[model samples]
Each structure stands twice: as structure tokens, then as C-alpha cells.
Target: MSVKFRPLADRVLVEPIKAETKTASGIIIPDTAKEKPQEGTVVAVGPGKKDEPTTVQVGDKVLYGKYSGSELKLDGKDYLIVKESDLLGILG
Candidate 1:
């Protein structure tokens, strides 16, 4: 996917991965009870601060703090703009 937005100064644009809607036992979870996903796919990345370069890259699956990042909508899709520091780690 091509995103028109680009983050600047060590920030990242993430497309949140939706939390599971069903349990292993086949129980359906309600929206009100679902927790925000702490994981997402990196959709866009910014140039690093003067000295440091951003590490994450687009298409990288990553883990982040549950409360990290600011939420926004693009093309009716939800996204998060977080600092590289807010990212916990890149998933293998």
C-alpha cells in the first residue's frame, strides 16, 4: 500500500493490527470488551534525528506500548503515529 503521509524526525506511521475477535474456544468477543492492539505493521517511517536514523521500516511487524502513539484516520482506515522510541520491538 502506498501512503501519502510520511513521518518526520524519528516518527513512524503504523497500521494497527486488529485484536482477535474470537477466542480459541470459539467465543466471540464484543467490541466494547476488546483491548486495543499493541501490535501493528509499519506503514511509513521518517528520517531519524540529526544523528540517529530510524530503525523500523515499512512492512515490518512490530510490537509497541499499549497506550503508545496518537490515533488518526486515513482513507477511512485507522492508523497510529508513534515515535520510534514508542515501539517496543520489531517482530520476526
Candidate 2:
């Protein structure tokens, strides 16, 4: 998964990972009942703000706040555009 869209300064483009469909009890959860995933793969990144540079890279998998970004679609796929500060951490 790669995208040609590039983010401006301090902004990042993320491809959100879908939430789990099954619970621990083995119940199959429907899409309408599922929560939006907080984790995502970094698809594109901005250069930096004037003084502060973004720590995340394009390929990094990151955790962000649940309601952090604005949703957009590119090539029929969903993506989020969030500020670097909205990102919580990078996944190992």
C-alpha cells in the first residue's frame, strides 16, 4: 500500500487499520457496531513545521488519538490527515 498524495508541513497521511470483527467471546461483530481503529500505517508524511520536525516516517505503523484526524478518500480507499502531535506513538 502506497499513495502518491503528499502531506504539507506538520501533517501526515495514514491508512487506518480496521478494528477487529470478533470479540474475545468469539462473537462476530458487525461493521456498524465496530469502533474506528486507532492504529494505522503511515502512508505519507510532511517535511516538518518550521521548528518542529515530524518523527514518523511513511512506512511506520503508528497509534493516534481516536478522533484525531479528518477523513478523506483516495483511490476509493479511506485515509486520515492528522497533525504530527496527534500521533501517540510508533508501533514496533
Candidate 3:
């Protein structure tokens, strides 16, 4: 991923994964009831603050809290900017 926007000082830019929109039975879920995704791929990461380096890196798929990070849009795609602490863990 080549994002022009780079995060600074412990901030990370993440591309959020979309939540499931259908059930196992093939039921289509309406937009109004869709849950915000809690998983995403780390697109960019900033240099860590003094004495603490960032643990995650670009292309790392991570899980986070449901209400973590600030949301923003870049080139028509949604992204989140969160501190390294906000990320729960990296996915396999």
C-alpha cells in the first residue's frame, strides 16, 4: 500500500476491514444495523515515542477495540489513527 499520508509520533494508520453483512442463512443485513469493524490491516505506522517503539508494522492485520482510534478518510477509503496501545494484537 502506498499512502501519501504518514502518521507521526506513535500514531498508526489502519485500513479497516468491513464487517459481515450477511448471515449464515444468507440473510442480508441492512446498513443501519451494521456493526463497525474491529479488525483492520495496518497501512502505515509512525516512529514510536521516546523509549517506546511501535510493535506493529505495515501489512500487519490487527485486532482492536470496537471503539478505538479516530476515523478519517483518504482517497475515498476509510482509515483509523490509533496509538500502539490501542491495538489489541496481531492476527496470524
For model 1, how does the per-residue alpha-carbon lDDT over 1-92 read when each residue is reduced to its tens digit? Answer: 98899898999999999999999999999999999999999999999899899989899999999999999899999999999999999999
TM-score of each: 0.97, 0.91, 0.96
Candidate 2 contains a number of clashing pairs equal to 0
The per-prediction CA RMSD against the true structure, in angstroms, equals 0.6, 1.2, 0.8
1-92 in candidate 2: lDDT tens per residue?
A: 66879899999999999889999999999999999899999999999989899899989999999999999999999999999999999999
As for candidate 1, its clashing pairs are none
Lowest-scoring 10 consecutive residues by lDDT in candidate 3? Answer: 1-10
- Model 2 reaches what TM-score against the true structure? 0.91
Whole-model lDDT values for every prediction: 0.95, 0.94, 0.93
Clashing pairs in model 3? Answer: none
Q: For residue 82, what is the lDDT in candidate 1?
A: 97
**Regions of candidate 2 where Cα sits further than 4 Å from its true position:** none
Name the candidate, 2 or 3, with the larger lDDT value: 2
Candidate 1: lDDT over CA atoms? 0.95
Q: Please report how far candidate 2 places residue 10 from its true position, in Å.
A: 0.4
By lDDT, the better pick of 1 and 3 is 1
Name the best candidate (by TM-score): 1
